[model samples]
Target: MADLLVRGGTVVDGTGAPPTPADVRIRGGVIVEVGPGLAPAGGAERVVEAGGAYVAPGFIEAHTHVDGAMWWNPDLDPLPAYGTTTVVFGNCGMSVAPLRESARGPVLDLFCFLEDLPLSAFQDKVPWTWERWPEYRRAVEGQAVSVNVAGFVGHLTLRTTVMGAEASWGRAATGEEIAEMAALLDESLTHGAIGLSTNVFDKDRYLKPVPTRLAEDAEFEALADVLARHPGATLQLITRFNEPDNIDADVERFARICKPRGIRAQWTAIPSTVREDYLREQTIALHRRLRADGVDFWPNVPHKPLEPFFNFERALTFQRVAAWNHWINGPAETKLATLADPQWRARAREDWDNRVSSSTSRLDRPESLILAISETGHGPLGISLKEYADREGLHISDALATWIGHNGILSCLRGIPDAFDEPVVAGLFAEPHTLTNINDSGAHLQLFCGSGENVYLLTRYVRDTGLLSVEQAVHNLTGKLAGFFGLGDRGVIAPGLAGDLVVFALDEIEVRPEEKRYDNPDGSWRFTRGPAGVRATIVRGVPTVLDAEPTGERPGTMVGLVSPPN
Candidate 1:
């Protein structure tokens, strides 16, 4: 007998096929039938009337930093609400396993620095009861997660575990250390890790390079050999792609690792900007050439502009610049003192001027920074910094600094840029090798909220601009990602597949405005946004989200690269 039946809906099937009226029946968490006019064999236990809605396979988040959030937010709110039934965590070289007792502080420090997680959250919330990857897997598997989680063993954690604090400072590992790291990775893969993730494009909060940036070629080749031994394992990387030759070199290294073993490699943050048209063309062409040579290389492209709401209190964007690094990374008292120092302010002005003249910095245009929320009388609400600075006859940096000094920690500067070139984005989506979702959902929580990108795509692209058909959009979010990540039985709605699905009305879909929520483990505030028009989201035949609300159900399970369903 069927456990649940979704009746009278237009099934899109996540295959880029046209939608058709069909009834889907689920028995014991697997779809038993997907056909028209099929009656429930035993008058099924529960029935969802998906009439006037599109019933499609649940969306898969291709990249995320939910490694810490999973511990505190087992329900994983705002994610399942956005119709993401599965998430790929441990992205960008950060994970929470393979830690020795001595390496715990440095690993957590690295995570807190790179991912912007609060130190108290890890110290207070995470149990810290496990050391090995398998033990960590068991601990996570024992939890009640709301969405399917497929995690990767982070390269930083493995290196730190093998080499101690030296790894944090980017020291080169010896051959013996490399061998130990490979063995640890193998153990992690043996016990349900999906693959390995590393980063070359990130820096710590102190403006130092991450450990993976200093890794030698021999280290990565050894790790790749371990991945090669395990046939379905993948390599997730954050490569240096600002320069064309840098991109080519990174791809060449990845191709050398993946091509011979038929291993798949995925990279992130392929921006949708008109400014880098020539670079985009060269990168896409390189991707094609690599694929033609039989390397399963894929670049994850973002569907939205990389804009975020930031404030001087905990700004992640400005920290990249050398001048602002001291003020941004210092303690509150130190920042306060520096903000008042005339000499320091003068140097900061010079730094801002230099950055403005450079073509590389996104913080160049003062007009792009608008006041979102504030608690001071320095300027009226909704005024751009450039306008305010011009009216007051002050440099933009000085004006911003004065406002922060007066407002303290209560000023929010938001960058709400115009949308990207729609036709170009549509073309990228239509490309065969480009994976379109890299939301970075659970990271940078305080600075921005990108978890809503899935719903944003559905509302803006499919419903509004008509850049993507509903079927194509659904395929990009679901089937293509699942197939790429080897979750073969879950991305499509077919007989014998997992009954993970989303039901939503096309016209009613909308992404809500961002708001602050103090929901993290230590009561630190982070921006959050919700979704509208999603009727229900089911994971493995259970409704994790129903009627636009979480049902408090956690039927989600851990998925591995080559392992069977958990």
Candidate 2:
């Protein structure tokens, strides 16, 4: 890498301290100096004028599901431009490694269902050459990407690898199988895995519990034991706050198992919207109890609301609604047939009416659902579903079906966002035992755009609302995340640290609107956005994105607690 000098900027330093005017110098991917009036070494250094910009450590995407997408979408577009330099993958109990040859199809199905990715995209794009976590890491290290990547070993992947493809879903693991899984997890952690991620709160499109939910207590104990041996490793538990029937028991189980073992744990997430006030209170109480009990646990609160766009072609958005679930997961021929069937419409209307009150889906509030994107320049593109229903003189369920028949099956629907409870949101951001910005970026590419939502913390919370200071926001995005993940080498603009930095004026950046991009390997389209107007995004002294455009440099490599960013 070339030696670079960034001059004429206010340094945030990623420590939550006040900004200071300084010059930062980098040599061979490491920060050599960070102070005022630093001069370039002879004429061999490249100078970047950071006039009127705040130079800060590059942002870290704390939780993501980019395990499968990283292979196909190596550039990780829109993130580098949004000032994100590091990404953690293999979240929500899904990783792309340690697979059995016979379980590949089943694993792909699970990933696609959970992440809302197309099965064809995974089949056509990912190389799938590695079977173990270490081998997966090696393969990833060889690839060129713009953002540094780390991941957790998935419990579902481990179960499927040891137990047969059929047995992993239907029964608890045998004692021998649990031992094999523990050994594999130990080996993964010994190599470079950040931790173990398991899910207990989700169901597939078929409304069946995910495979990780079938894991027994013995399996969890063994996994927690492995994490105990590996210092700084975390136990990420994915829980369902919306359908929180077993939430209390699930959290108690996680704490009871991991806390005694001295393993750090994090769950996704606490509710942040007014509609979920009850859930938010319940979660806060749970968090307080966990902390009182001397547990090292963090509840993840998303900085952005979960405003999802739905389409019939491929989406799990309607999984909670039984009739819609059948239509969504059915074959192409069955999709049109069911939509036109009177019996299906009746069932769908009944299901929409009888949906549980705790359901967060827009099905409960179809009036807030809009007919957003059209596939073929069709009429009635931008209207509420209720308005359309009124105009067509039909029930809401029948109206949606009729609209889809008139328009194409590929058209999309979107839900209007609810206002965030600002005080609660601010509290979550300020709390020490909370993880903010848990955007599931790189997953749910088709259903929603999670890529640039991190910028909302900077744009809305810091600048617009004044809920958080610039220093605090920068610290949460950088230093706090680094400390939590045990990444000691980066996330701060200090001497001897990696030169991963983002430089931009506060007024210059804004999260762009979502647009359709047809760049998938399978010739499919996905929702994407433009940059947030970052002047420069440097990864390890190399400019991955400069002046609002990608420099096409792939300086990022596998990042872990033990392995520094390469």
Q: Which stretches of candidate 1 lie over 4 Å from their true place?
A: 41-44, 243-245, 353-361, 562-566
Candidate 2: clashing pairs of residues: none
lDDT for 294 (candidate 1): 83
- Top TM-score: which candidate number? 2
Residue-by-residue lDDT tens digits, candidate 1, 325-406: 6677677767767888899988888877665232234577678788777766655668887887888788878888777777
Residues 1-566, model 2: lDDT tens digits:
56899999999998888999999999998899999998878777878889899999999998888777777888888789889899998888888777877888888898988788778878877877788888888888998898899888888888888897789888998899999999999999888898999998888777888888898888899989999998889988987667778678888888989878988889867888897888888888999999999999988887787677888887777777789887877787777777888888999989877766655777778788989877777759778998999999998878998888778788888889887797788777787778876888887877778888777888888899899988888888888888778787888899888889999887999988888899877788887888889899999888888988888888899988752434
Top model number, lDDT: 2
TM-scores for all predictions: 0.94, 0.96
Q: In order, what lDDT does every prediction score?
A: 0.80, 0.84
Cα lDDT over the full model 1: 0.80
Residue pairs whose backbone atoms clash in candidate 1: none
Off by over 4 Å in 2: 376-378, 390-393, 563-566
